[model samples]
Target: MLDHVQIADAIAESLITNGVRTGTRLPTQKELGESYGAPRHSIRKALDLLEKRGVLGARQGSGTYVLGQLVDYQISSRTSYNHNVRRLDASPTIEFLELRTRQATPEIARGLGINRSARIFDLYVLRRSNGEPLCLARHYLSEDRFPTLSEHLEVATGISDLLRRIGMQDVRRSNSSISARMPAKHEAALLEIPQASPVLVLEGRNVDAKGVPVEISTSVWPASRIKVHV
Candidate 1:
């Protein structure tokens, strides 16, 4: 006799074999119970476990839905999301989540080579591929270098394009650091993965021709879907 946990694993396997994908609703508790020869309560428990593992999600007043695997992302000093998406023949889009002016923290100052408490422009962006969320990025730009940055840049404009348009040509990535950890509650919600899912973090700096740091970026991607290439 299979336990609720075992039943849940079996259901997950069934989902893949049946071609069920992200956003595909699973059968109702009663139906699952009947199919698996288990009690309704056990079926619910199975679903709950799956949800905690980020394999499924239960929406209010809606049925539980399958949560698909994370999208793969490649990280490198020369990483260009636009180019990568084009190479993969996937539609890529960027969504601006927030923009604000704030004083830089010591860490941000170090990354951008600015003084602590210096004014900076913060831009939060969500990058998607084929309508699926992929990564969340936070950008810090030195206000002194591009005072009118917020007014000139749009959500659709790539960072490289923005630099060229603003007369900051020849900008290149100066440094990047990578790390990994489980996602936080809010981050998990934004990425539509379970809270226990791991995320890859990349911290990078971009410099102009003079080698002066102009921008600092920190992005988090789903670890399950992305691999860091050097």
Candidate 2:
């Protein structure tokens, strides 16, 4: 009897050999088990392992489907999600989840160089490629510095666009730190990944031409879907 690892390897090879198209759903666990001469439990474990490896994705109440190629995302002085996705011939869109003013925490205060508990504009957005959720980003901006930020966001395309509209022409990345960990429940649901799947966390601060911190952001990406290039 083949173990789960070996079963997963076999299934992956079958997918490639059969030229299974991306987004094509696989057979049910029982069907796969019968075809592979393995038990249903072993088939389930193999599916799970394949999902974690980014070769497949499981949809709730649906079935497992083949995933697309990994996206190459570059980190540089000026990193734009839209630009990056477009460079790979993919359509990119941003969904603004929230825009609110809130008191800054100790970490936020330090990142933005503001007083603790200072009011800041909390901007939350979900970015997608070809309608597939790819990243969740949260941006903190000092409200006092840009009192009309909310107004601009209402009509602007994105953070960078709004900043330019408000007369910030020269904005660049000042610093960045990358880390990895398993996704949280909410994060997993939002990014449409299994809770057991790992995610890449990017924390960074953007500065203006004057070298003053303008935006402190935290972005989360599904590790399986994204390949970060520093």
For lDDT, the strongest prediction is 2
* TM-score quality measure for candidate 2: 0.76
Off by over 4 Å in 2: 1-48, 52-65
lDDT (Cα, tens digit) per residue for candidate 1, span 1-230: 67988997788667644545467788899999889999988899999888776778899999998775433345565667777655556677788889899999999888888889789999988887677787899989988878978776673366666667778767777788999999888888888787777788988888888888988899998764454565
| Ten residues in sequence with the least summed lDDT for candidate 1 | 68-77
lDDT of each: 0.78, 0.85
Candidate 2 residue pairs that clash: none
- lDDT at position 198, candidate 1: 75
Q: Candidate 2's residue-wise lDDT over 11-43, tens digit each?
A: 877775454556888999999999889999999
